[model samples]
Target: MSKKGKEKEEETMTFKLETAPFDPRFPNTNQTKYCYQSYIDFHRCRRIRGEKYEPCNYFKKVFTSMCPNAWVEKWNDQIENGTFPGRI
Candidate 1:
């Protein structure tokens, strides 16, 4: 196959986007707490299990999909600055 053909094939390939699955603990319509919790859980899991642990990716995916980009950015900044409100 030609380079252009392979590139076109890659571009045309479909990738599905998914949101976090439902959790009974956060059954309410509002998912604010769910998002926040996932964020904290992700960091906590990383701290406890180390960065290479695969399960921690789940929490990261959940928060990234559910939380607003701006909120995630702010929280990331807070974490970097050691001012994140949640205990992680």
Candidate 2:
């Protein structure tokens, strides 16, 4: 493909794989699942953008703003123990 075509494709390819339900607060359960998914999305973003400071900055901001510290800590532990559900 031409450079211009590739640029247009990249622009259109911007996507958010993780999304909250229509009414996130409606669920009887706590928001643990929401936080966990955002954590996973952060890692996925890093994986796609490479392990660099700049590329993953947006995701870092997103998860940090949305997910709590305790949940993120637990998820990190699970990841270290090789038991996290997501591939990343």
Candidate 3:
């Protein structure tokens, strides 16, 4: 449990994020693609900016706008566990 707790706070700087508007281009109205892409972008941003979360703030808004808190939390866990399906 203690180990898990520390992992929860773990941070990595190995990705990038795009400031341009996110566009999935699919006809589906659901924001799944947008959220996933945002996830990727967020990490990309972190990679460039380092472990500090401030530099990746914009991507946070992009994902939070299209995805629910629960989904984001779950995906974040997947990312730390090396199970995220998206490229980062």
Candidate 4:
């Protein structure tokens, strides 16, 4: 019973998502980002802070606060290639 009020607050970041431009190939309108937005935002903020932080295991969860598709894609690709540990 005492544990209920003692839950910890985890720090998190927000990502702003951009709608995909109209493309003739895909007529159906849709909201899409090259990479997960949450990853970009959290990673950027964490890196800027520059200190030991609890590592986030999940990096592919999409959020509406991502920076930009291009930016996120660049980092995501690099991570997949093993250029970096992982995205935020």
On lDDT, the leading prediction is 1
> Model 3, range 23-67, lDDT digits (tens) per residue?
757347676777777778888989887868796977777887777
Pairs that clash in candidate 1? none
Clashing pairs for predicted structure model 2, backbone only: none
For all predicted structures, in order, the TM-scores are: 0.85, 0.53, 0.59, 0.27
Model 4 stretches astray by more than 4 angstroms: 1-37, 40-64, 85-88
Error of 3 at 26 (Å): 6.0
For model 1, how does the per-residue alpha-carbon lDDT over 1-88 read when each residue is reduced to its tens digit?
Answer: 9999999999999899899999999999999999999999999999999999999999999999999999999999999999988899
Q: Ten-residue segment with the worst summed lDDT in candidate 3?
A: 11-20
Residue 44, candidate 3: Cα error in Å is 0.9
Better of 2 and 4 by lDDT: 2
Cα lDDT of candidate 4 equals 0.48
Mind giving the per-residue lDDT tens digits that candidate 2 earns over 1-88? 9999999999998877654443354365666666556667678877787778485665566567667788778878988898877777
Flag regions of model 2 displaced more than 4 Å.
1-34
What local distance difference test score does each model get?
Answer: 0.96, 0.70, 0.77, 0.48
Candidates 1 and 4: which is better by lDDT?
1
lDDT of 1 at 66: 94
lDDT score for residue 76 of model 2: 87
Better by lDDT, candidate 3 or 2: 3
lDDT (10s digit) by residue, model 4, range 1-88: 3554444322234466554334354344343432344465556656675445444323223332324567667766887787865454
